[model samples]
Target chain A: MGVQDAEPLDVERIREDFPILDREVGEGTDLVYLDNGATSQTPESVVETMSEYYRTYNANVHRGIHRLSQEASIAYEDAHDRVAEFIGASGGREEVAFTKNTTESMNVVAYAWGLSELGPGDEVVLTQMEHHAALVTWQQIAKKTGAEVKFIRVTDDGYLDLDHARELITDDTEMVSVVHVSNTLGTVNPVSELADLAHDHDALFFVDGAQAVPNRPVDVEAIDADFYAFSGHKMCGPTGVGVLYGKRHLLEEMDPYLFGGMMIKKVTFEESKWNDLPWKFEAGTPPIAEGIGLHAAVDYLESIGMDRIQRHEERIVEYAYDRLTDHDDVTVFGPPGDDRVGLVSFDLDGVHPHDVSQILDEHGVAVRAGDHCTQPLHDVLGVSATTRASFYLYNTREEVDALVEAVDAARELFAV
Target chain B: MVGSDMYRQQILDHYRNPRNHGELEDPTFSHVGENPMCGDEITMDVELAEDGETIERVAFRGEGCAISQAAASMLSERLPGKTLSELREMDRDDVLDMLGVDISPMRIKCAVLAEKVAQDGAEIYLGEKDLDRTSTE
Candidate 1:
């Protein structure tokens, strides 16, 4: 759908699509789920899609020539096509590969590219706000390859210091990987600009879109991202499936990271030939039902229009940020203006995040409390942990009010 | 006032003004325990008597929610006048009884961080095990 054709979301109608939204938490209290940053609630359509796939065509994909296998293969390939279209990948399904999750996708890049391309003097540039999936994977690979790893600094207000990024991305930089949207800080990075900068330095760029692709409109072609990774579970789809999109030329140049049955064209006692484009990277039986479920989720988002979802989450998060900061005891982290995405991380004076989250749970408000997989970023923020409340398309302003009231109850109980 | 049953007045008082809330000048055993998931940490410093089996004095330093800090404070107070064997024998129920509150399954780690630290410290002091630190992951 075009951006101009996007309509405002009817949140009340949308909430009905998710049965979990109607459930109760503690003492029969209505659940206020604000943990979308962790995992989004699946719609009934996506759930039904997976259930139907197992019930109807319960067979292996790609190898079997039987009717069920053909049907499953067609559906799985179509799922990849849907994902490629959703992200505006120019090479379409040929450039998209499925992995267990975003972590595995990054590992695939590290194994296929980093292991072969990087050497002792090569540098891998990453941001300080990266989730451990990107940080630890590259750290270990750099160690194994004897490649140096550099980190771009985050400003005190929680932004990637572009000046620092420019200073760091010089001649020796062989790879630049960054999070498109920070899970902890909710900072929406200028990824396209970063991608251009990396290309200018003759470096490969990778975007960890685990937090970005689900919440906003992303066109890999527009941003010129050499590689992008995202998970289905964070976007109203089932777990056990993720997507990795790379340029066709780069994908062809890199060797397969996984080796198994379906990914082989022919196998002999002495030699084996790899399969074509995406399947060469996708080994083993693959997550057949999960890929189909992700397709349904992509259709659901497309029906609602991503532009509209982005606007709704923007309003909800801004309102939440304002309400949370109104209290003297609360201190909200991240950018002060409207540059942030759909989450808010904050701390209460004299009250631990776990305590705040526990109290919020008592009121049936679910939130995330911890380092959010970015321990270094937490250290940079000068705090141990922060309570985070994230919003999605189905969230409403009333729920934001409920979150504020529960937070108030926590502060009052702690007498902070 | 939701979950007030878990945050009783005693827990709050101990959390606010923790007893034995400092480090000992010289300690027979000092160990740090951490629940990295919640960023809760507790450090216990115990000074043994001449007999080397009884805890003569103890102090604790920590940063965490009320359950962890209050439980650590209470554990520090109970350490003195208790033998090392008794300290080792202290279990989850004892910590729950000391808190006098219902700790949910998720917060049980926060509630029992102190007991683990002390017991592990006692083990290290006795040369029963060689370890760097303790973790309630």
Candidate 2:
């Protein structure tokens, strides 16, 4: 509650690594980007790595016998290894599959596992705070399979109601999927405990780690997650690439999500045998350049420890929370504690989030204002929308000050 | 001072004291609409005159940003005595012109939500469309 210690991150030097941080928006105003939760700006190392790949050996992976193809394939495969190691997936590349984004990763599992396994009267346990990616996917799958989808209630203070989860994950629960961190509330759910509960119920544990893998230290094996999914764009990596880590046995047992050129072992006119793990799921040409960029992104994140980055975000979020809550007209949502992720969702007393966001944009401070792809959670919070300012390793206290000032400007304009 | 350019004086005034802001007791046509992207919602209710052609009374109830609520208020103030055909003819430009401000492309849906609801209500009332609600996504 008092002035905390300074974060142990050289944010200024880190800022220099991101060139766009030096750019301006709206008539020479410096950009105070607080939309990291949506998509993080790629650092120079990642951009350069992708550029180098394209500038040199650019070819289709896993097919050609030529030198360039071999180089591309090796780099692409190494990208999978890099991701697996970063997330502490002991099965390594054999268990990690590349998808377009976290949404695609969830879909892969839903198609390969959910459609095949879920049946009438079965249940899929999910959290109310889940993004539409996991929520809608499982919902539609349940509808198709005649399976029921139940939600774990979110507490008033923005936490997973573990008691509700315990009640929901009973004998008939087929899958228990939840977000490791709530994108809207920044509430870090107790995923390991949830995973253990799912395991006890004989349900497959799936984690939507889109917000968590990039912010904090994640060990898929340690958490004993059956499947963990995260996006590249949220971790200072390039778009069009994401990683899904599944336990080796589960992934090997599941059917292929897609079928095409590279994922088959032997194709006849009537039948086809699928390739080994991972490639069996990734159909056609993979995101070669984006995958390499993500490898570089992982390298960059590792260079600056994830623990330090987490601490830095905590400091910045705490500062923003303190500054914004200082005003009588502002109301911050989520948990009133220090253990949240590096973001804050709040509402102005009379102003709408869209208007508040427009005002913030005018002041060159970018924040997300909407349901944040969690409409059900917003309903639970009793708000149609909320203004969210998400932080990252590069975000600074000065940027938080700018966000508060811009919010003040919005409140003043609507005060009359 | 910063966001005043977008939230003009007229827009702010209408937003603060919206005109005809409530549900009509007995209305000929009522339609609910929303901009799902930003979660802005508006419900429009209209009472037709004795002739059953002109708008005898109009009221709206909803929650949204300054641009959306103000535009709804401004549109409600201009709805009396207008025929269903005229209401259906009203478009995005008419709503923007009523607000007297440049709505950014992102917030244009917010600025035109009420118009969509009112126009859709008139269309449904005239049996031109078989839709219950409208959305400016």
Candidate 3:
């Protein structure tokens, strides 16, 4: 899919692929689902792929020489190839390691890399807008290794303070991990520039692509990231399956995250040798059926084209940002322009976010209301919580209008 | 207008025009309870003349969702001249029953916010703190 030749996203056609979109919530009210940032609705094809995998090839891979094992192994390895190509990883299929979710992927990096390399007098640079998964894992590694974790401050408008980021990345910095797109504020950080800066400092750059991979086109090779992590559920695939992409050289250098049966090449009473790049990271029996579903999800996204998905979400975000900003009582928090994903965080005057969400729910609109697991960013914004409404290809402009009307109704009813 | 059935008429009436939605001056006993998850802050005050263990005067001031604000207004109306023991004996079910409609389980906290504040105020009025006052236990 070339940039100029990308076909425009057909929302109605896409919505038809998701059966849950047709169901009504309360008293024949249409379900206006705007919570795609939390978890996307899987298409029928992806669901059917998982069902087909279980019904057909229900056997363990890499152990048995039987026909079922061979079929399962081929399916599992094919899924890895699809995912590797999806993310634009330079290495071949062996570089992609399956994990439980993005959180586990990040923990693998922190434990395998951070625990081994970082020690006393070492520093790790992070950002204020990171989800707790990235923040807590690094914090734990820093505490255990007697290293210090520093943060790059975020401005009130939710852009990264690049000057602070540059100042934080010094010679002592050993690793720099940041979110590609903020889950709370929806600000798209400049990962390529940050990656360059980390390379300049001789530090490894790990990009938390959990939020970015679902909404935009992610090319890890273009960004030159050392490690990239994303979850399948957030990308319209099933839960309990995620990908951890690493450069071949860095992956070979790092130790295995888990010591188990499948991760070992050969085990003796005294010594054990770990397997190659991906198998070393993936211990025990993996989520084989989930992997097949994720391959279907990747195919679904590719059929629609990620560039078109970005443009489609950009249009909706621009419209929603304008509508939200036009309201006198609304206080929007995030990037002022359309340089972000479809996630929008805002607060209405004198109304709590929970109250706003409840009122919207009464109107058959769904949204998320909380700190969004970005407490440090919330502290920087000086607000406790905000109501978030994220969009996807299945969302229509009419849903945006409905959200606006419901928000106005909530404000009028609360009189705040 | 929201449905009168979903939100009871009294609840909407109180939410639209609350009775006590401002701070009290030198309240005899006051405390602030906040839902950090949603940033809803409730500062309740209780002025008790206390005619033989009876709450002579009870009032509250806070900002929250409709359910919380309506519950506070109704509690203010019901607690004045009620006995301290009676207020302490109040349960979440009693608060929801007063709302005149059943609410989702998640919103039970909103319905009980005022009752908890009143109980805390009653405990302060009796000069007791850091003690469990819930009737369920």
Candidate 4:
């Protein structure tokens, strides 16, 4: 398709691909799903790919020489290649390791890398905007190793405290793990600059790309991330599958997180040697079907082209920000410009987020009402929670209009 | 499915103009209950007469969802004349039933935010410092 002739994403067609969006909660209201950041709706192609795996090549991968086993193994490894290519990994297929989700992927680094490299008096720098999955893992590692965990304070506008980050990264810092995007504020962090600073200080940089991967193109090689982690469910794929991309040299040096059947190259009674990269990190029965589903999700994303998706979401973000800012009661967080992704978090005057969410739900507008799993950021903002309405390719400006109208209705309903 | 009339007129009546939304003057007992998962916070204060067993007045101050604020408003009107024992016996289901709605399981915490605050305040009034007992209800 030519640039001008390329058809805009058909919301109705995309809506039909998701079966769950059709179900009505109350009355005849159509589901105005805006919670894509929490978990996106899977397309039919991804769901069908998973079902096909179970129906045809339902065998444990990389274990047997049978036809079904070989097919399943090939499909599984092909998924690794697709994921690696999608993320711009240069280490080829060996760099991708499948885990349960972003949480598990982060835990692998915390256990394998942090345990080995981090010691007492060492500092692990993190940001205030990181999700608990990234924060808690490092806190646990710090507790066990007696290493200090330094936090980069956030600016009042919810961007990273870059000045504080510079001060925090010292010679004693062992690693700098930060989120590529703020899940709550929707601020795209400066991962490339942070990675450069960490490298200068002789510390490795790990990025939590769970929110970044779905909204924009994530080239791990371009950012030069020593370790990167992301989840499939947040990107229109099935759950129980995630990718942990590590530098080949780093994965080679780190020990395996788990020791079990699939990860072993050779096992003896007294001693056993682990396998090489990727498989060394994956132990026992992996989520083979989920991996297949993720591959299909990558296919769907590529078909639309990441550049197109980015443009589409950027438009929605700009539209929503303008609409929300027009209201006198609405308080939109994050940067004012279209520098962020599709997520928009805000609060209405005289109405709590829970109340706002309920009123929106009555109109079939699904929004998230909570801290968005960034408690430290919430604490800094001095608000308990804010209602978030995140968009995807399927969302349109009309839906953002619906959201604005719902907020106005809520304001009138709760006028006191 | 809860009926189309799930949010009762009474609930809306309370939510639209919540009663006792301000503070109580020199309250004898005050407690704060926070839903850490969702960031809903409710602070309740109870003032007792000289007898100290009967609630003279009750008020709530906090920010939360409608279910929570409505429940708090309803509880303030329901418990002012009642004894402390009756407030302690209140359950989350009782609050939802009073609201006249079948809330989703995930939103049950919103419905119970006020009840938690009342229970915590009651425990504090009886000089019980432990929060575990208050959290159970």
Q: Per-residue lDDT for A214-318 in model 1, tens only?
A: 889999999899999999999999999999999999999999998888888999999999888899999998999999999999999989989998878888888
Superposed model 1: Cα runs more than 4 Å off: A1-6, B1-3
| Cα DockQ of the candidate 3 complex | 0.45
Top lDDT: which candidate number? 1
Which 10 consecutive residues of model 3 chain A have the lowest summed lDDT? A1-10
* Candidate 4 local lDDT, A1-416, one digit each (tens): 53234446666777777888787766778788899999999999999999999998899999999999999999999999999999999787799999999999999999998998889999999998899999999999999999999999888787888889999999999899999988888898999999999999999999999998987889999999999999999888999999999999999999998889899899989988988779999999999999999999999888877777777887888899998889788888887747778889898987778778888888889999888888778888888889999999888888899898888778767665
Better of 1 and 3 by DockQ: 1
Interface RMSD for each predicted structure: 1.9, 1.6, 2.7, 5.3
TM-score of each: 0.97, 0.96, 0.91, 0.92
The alpha-carbon deviation from the true structure for residue A134 of candidate 3, after best TM-score superposition, in angstroms, is: 1.4
Model 3, A240-269: lDDT tens per residue?
A: 999999999988998988888889999999
What's the residue-level lDDT of A254 in candidate 1? 91
**DockQ ranking, best first:** 2, 1, 4, 3
What TM-score does candidate 3 reach?
A: 0.91
Off by over 4 Å in 4: A1-16, B1-9, B21-30, B47-56, B120-129, B132-137
Candidate 1 chain A: minimum summed lDDT over ten consecutive residues — where?
A1-10
In terms of docking quality, model 3 is acceptable
Provide the lDDT at A110 for model 4.
97
Look at candidate 2 and tell me the lDDT of residue A379: 88
Per-residue error at A250 for model 1, in Å? 0.7
